[model samples]
Target: NNRFTERNRCPADIEKNLEYITLIWLDENIDDSNESVQMQRLLYKMNNYVLLYTDPHLCIDYIKTIVDENIILIICASLHELVLPIIHSLNTVRAVFLTCNDHLKLTSVCSEYPKVAAICTDQQQLIKSIHGTIQSMSNQTMSFTLFDSNKQNSTRDSASILWYRLLIDILKTLPHTDQSKNEMLDKCAEFYRFNEAELQKIDMFRTSYTASKAIEWYTSECFLYKLLNKALRTEDIDLLYVFRFYIIDLYSQLELEHHKQFRINNNWDKLIVAISWASNFKR
Candidate 1:
């Protein structure tokens, strides 16, 4: 009865997600007790979509269905040897969290697979591992390419990096309305749904946020930080469209500061401007 509860849900579609990371846990006794439900509650807090399964086969089958989203797979230590080999090569599986009482002993087994992000002996450690893993992935280097008019032969990989830059440049030129901000807020409110803390942060954003303070709100690491980073990491066009209002704001503020720093310098020829796009942009 404690599963999912009535709050902290993104959308009902297991196949689709608004954010990037989808937390899937597989273990026969995953929800066998109230303690299990409490642990899941924490996972759901870290991510809106949390799926718990008892059957490993069902878990693997469902993971195969995921597209354009990163999966954080959680399993008991007992299942490590049996399940790790099967899902190790699946590109969708971003990070694996192994839960067991004797994680120290399982290190050698898990080290064989590069996707195994962490081995946690307890629920608290599991939560910490998941959060840290996602944060690290979100901070991964973005794709970048120097577009040279002199060089006519750019590979598809380089084209993608240039696309990110062009996309941002085009967005900065377009017009964003207040409705964009409201739409983004509405989506955030819906995704967070009944979560009190996130809703409170959203309310604060609505009441106090401004264009000039874009960097501040982003650095606050509130709901905006989480949502924005997830969409950019996955390159979810729909969510990014909703966030365009703030993206332009942030870029404009950055450019303003960038120019301000240049105006004080006499060496204009020596000046250089650098732009960095979003990540797990590493793809």
Candidate 2:
């Protein structure tokens, strides 16, 4: 499923904590009374929301003044490309939910910015995506609060603490090289050497995924062979084991594609060699 958000409903606390949400309705005139009723229903569900009906020609002038933080930007599809420059300028926009059906246009925009959280096919999906994104942001805020509270009593050295902070930031941003991963592991070793108890401090941050899982994601995406070679050269058996499953999964996917092509042309020789190459990692 290409689900933009979780299937689970938002918790009550997050709903109560919502500060403000902004909706930019681009249509200057709505002739249908039923559509107005639907708009009212959506507005009623949102918290402390400000609905701005903008003339398509004048949206640029009005959007310049909106500077609120933690904002969920809901805009009409017609204004998708027009508002992108404004969206780029506004760092306060946490996520974007669009009332758009132009799949190609949506794809192009999302490719440019992963922050375009969801493009709603209909009004119902738009509301759900906004609620989900808000809840996710709220949960992240709560986690940051708890993470800060837990570190209040920490007595680790400044160097170790700095590395720990840097490592967490790197993990959040991801796509770092194997060399960077090795550097992060070295920092962790330094942290452990200074005070073994400090290692437990990362438990809260790892709630999303263990370091192994993060490494698995990285190796699967790019540099799989290079990383495997680096792990062997560095005698990083732990890193090698962490990556084994990802390597195996990649080989399986590749082998399937190769087999399908071979079957079409009845090329038994190439298929045998490819299968043999994939199986060597099993040892």
lDDT of each residue in 1-283, candidate 1, tens digit only: 3344422222333435666678888777754467877887787777776787777776777777777678888888877778888888999899898888876688786569888888888777888889998777655523322444346266953555555566677666767877878998998998777577889999998998889888677666577766776666566777777888887787666566556755534321110112332221224
- Among all windows of 10 consecutive residues in model 1, the one with the lowest summed lDDT is 267-276
TM-score, cand. 1: 0.72
TM-score (C-alpha, index-matched) for candidate 2: 0.40
Task: Give RMSD (Å) of candidate 1 vs. truth.
Answer: 5.9
**TM-score versus the correct structure, for each prediction:** 0.72, 0.40
Candidate 2 clashing pairs, residues 3+ apart or interchain: none
Candidate 1 — number of clashing residue pairs?
A: 0
The C-alpha stretches of model 2 lying farther than 4 A from their native spots are: 1-24, 28-32, 56-63, 143-283
Q: Write the per-residue lDDT of candidate 2 for residues 190-225, one digit (tens) a residue.
A: 423323333343332223434334323332312333
lDDT against the true structure, per candidate, is: 0.69, 0.46
Error of 1 at 29 (Å): 1.2
**Which stretches of model 1 miss by more than 4 angstroms?**
1-12, 101-108, 117-121, 141-176, 263-283
